[model samples]
Target: MDVLTTQTLSGVQTSIEIAGTVAFALSGVMEAARKKLDAVGVCAVASVAAFGGGTLRDVLLDRRPLFWIEQSWYLWSVLGLCIAAMVLMRAKHFKPTEKSMQWPDALGLGLFAASGTQIALGLQMPALIAVLMGVITATFGGVLRDIVCNEIPTAFHDHHPYAVCAFAGGWVVVVLHYLGFYPNAVVAIGAATVTLLRLAALQFEWRLPTWKIED
Candidate 1:
């Protein structure tokens, strides 16, 4: 795309990342509260969900001392958010929805997948490995959230379209890059693809088929 479109793409990617972080973090905290988890549990789940995927990707890619640790600001930002959400939630329990949060989870999932894949490609990681890292970075936190709360790891199951969304987003970035799209455009295209597919999948009840064994 042209310079303006590329710039717009970058903005979209960044916004999605921040929003995804906030949305997932909020989800973790809200769930924790619903389960009657303690304050520490609430904060821990929120923080972990916010940064867990990035941390795992950084470690896999051998990028230290990790994304949130290196940046530091993300920690504070998450903390501030948890505090605000806690106050609002204590006043009254608010359930998360697409209308309120505007699908930050899907948005963030796409961005992280694109971002992780790009960083891996830059480091010369194998394309397959890079895509795996992208998905891990995009969804591991949600997986951890489910596990910590004693639920099935959502990404590991056929419960919803979440994993496919992240995977499609990651692949979009890789495909666009191969087609000579710049990092910015590729990132936006990937995010949009993931988010769109995810929402569509939900609306239409699309899902990967479960294996069947005939006796």
Candidate 2:
């Protein structure tokens, strides 16, 4: 686990991010179930919300065979998570207790973002593009979720430094990698740092400014 947590953003650390993606995907399933969405609907929402950004990034970069496509397990794992979530929901009436989910979801965001950034670098992408990939990986799913729920995306109003933290941490890993640090460890630190900071922000109800314009 320490080694897993300490790697820089390489395919070597992709397993960690993949696990995080599964967790995030499961959360989406739980959310859909909470809304009493049907089986297909739940899976549909989870699939798009979980893997949307990564899929798009792969396509844009002309990453042949695609990220999930190459690793059949990636798609299978997401399906497995969705199935498990559905089964769990059916077994016990699904409800968000407010305590169980908040932190894991936040942590997952950090992990996925760092993972995405690393993957981009591994593909030899430019730093700006890699950072954008990280942001998308970390944040776009939540945006899709919000739209499905008919709410504003969380980051638009600066509810917290959600994407900012991910962006910074992903870049931290990338920079450290370029500076000769072991990719695996640096990535682990960056991802974990983002997770901790984000969780802390949520824990303390910390948020950025909400500007109001009045005529």
Candidate 3:
């Protein structure tokens, strides 16, 4: 790859990562509104939901200058969005339904899934491990958000193929990378795969079977 091409690819990857952060932040804000949290609590939850997974990923991978630290703009952006969301929630007629955050959650999941896989691959991690990292990167933030909000994490309980979507998208990224596709193309395809699969699962009520030990 040309030097300029590598720089361009890095810029694109950064954009995807930022977009994912924003999506998760919005999801957190919606959840906080549904819970009727105060401004401070909402901001706290939104920041965690926006940065928790990536922070964990960076720690696990021993990537220094953690992404949010490197891009402080993400924090500022989340703060601005959360402030706006709080104001919106103050409207007497405002009410967020149960399904309000689905789109942003799904989009964030896909983008983070691909981003995680790409980073792990860059580190020469095993394929399966890379995929797992991708899934963690995608879903862990939501887990933290739910935990903080005193709700069971949807990824663990929903059984709606949430992590499965991330897993599949991670593999898509891995396969594309092995096939010598451009990084941007790989990220796009993988994210799209996850996002579309999640939306379809929601639309069709697709689910993973539950385990039952009792007869």
Candidate 4:
């Protein structure tokens, strides 16, 4: 890749990461509020939700410094977002609900899926590995967040196509990149595809096949 192309890809990835971080942080904040956690707990949950998946991805990929560590502002930004969300929700007498949390979670899932797949592809990983990385980056943070909040991870139990959406979107990213689409456009389209698919699934009550173990 040319220097210009590399710079553009990096910029796109950074933008996607920022948006995904904020979305996941908001989801975490809402979940924490639903759990009636204190301010400190809220911030801690938000930080894990914002950083956990990416941290895992970096570790697996052997990327230095981790993205959040290299971009320290992410930590401060998530903290500020948690504080602001808590204060605003309180002032407005808003009750955080499981439904409200899903919106930001879906958006974050899509963004992370696209960004993660792109990053892995840039590293010359195999297409399957890249897609798996994207799925992991998109879903693992929510798993961590739910575990912290003492609940089953939605991705595993919801019977809705959560990581499935991310996996499909990752393939979209891979295909677009392989077809030589513009980096930014590939990311945007990939993210939108995943987000829209997830929202649609939620709206239409889509279901995955589950074992019908009789009690």
Worst lDDT 10-window in candidate 2: 1-10
Model 1 regions lying over 4 Å from their true place: 1-12, 98-102, 213-215
Model 4 ranges off by over 4 Å: 1-6, 9-17, 96-102
The alpha-carbon RMSD values of the candidates against the true structure, listed in the order shown, are: 3.6, 4.1, 2.7, 2.7
lDDT of 3 by residue, 113-165 (tens): 98788888878999998999899899889899999999999889877799999
lDDT by residue (tens digit), candidate 1, 16-53: 67898898898788778777898888889998788888
Cα-based TM-score, every candidate: 0.88, 0.82, 0.88, 0.87
lDDT of 1 at 205: 85
Task: Name the lDDT value of residue 128 in candidate 2.
Answer: 86
Q: How do the candidates rank by TM-score, highest first? A: 3, 1, 4, 2
Better of 3 and 4 by lDDT: 4
lDDT, candidates in the order shown: 0.78, 0.73, 0.84, 0.85
**Judged by lDDT relative to the true structure, which candidate is superior, 1 or 2?**
1
Sliding window of 10 residues with minimal summed lDDT for model 4 = 1-10
State the TM-score for model 2. 0.82
Q: Tens digits of per-residue lDDT for model 4 on 141-214?
A: 88899999999997899789999999999999999999999877888899999999999999999999878877
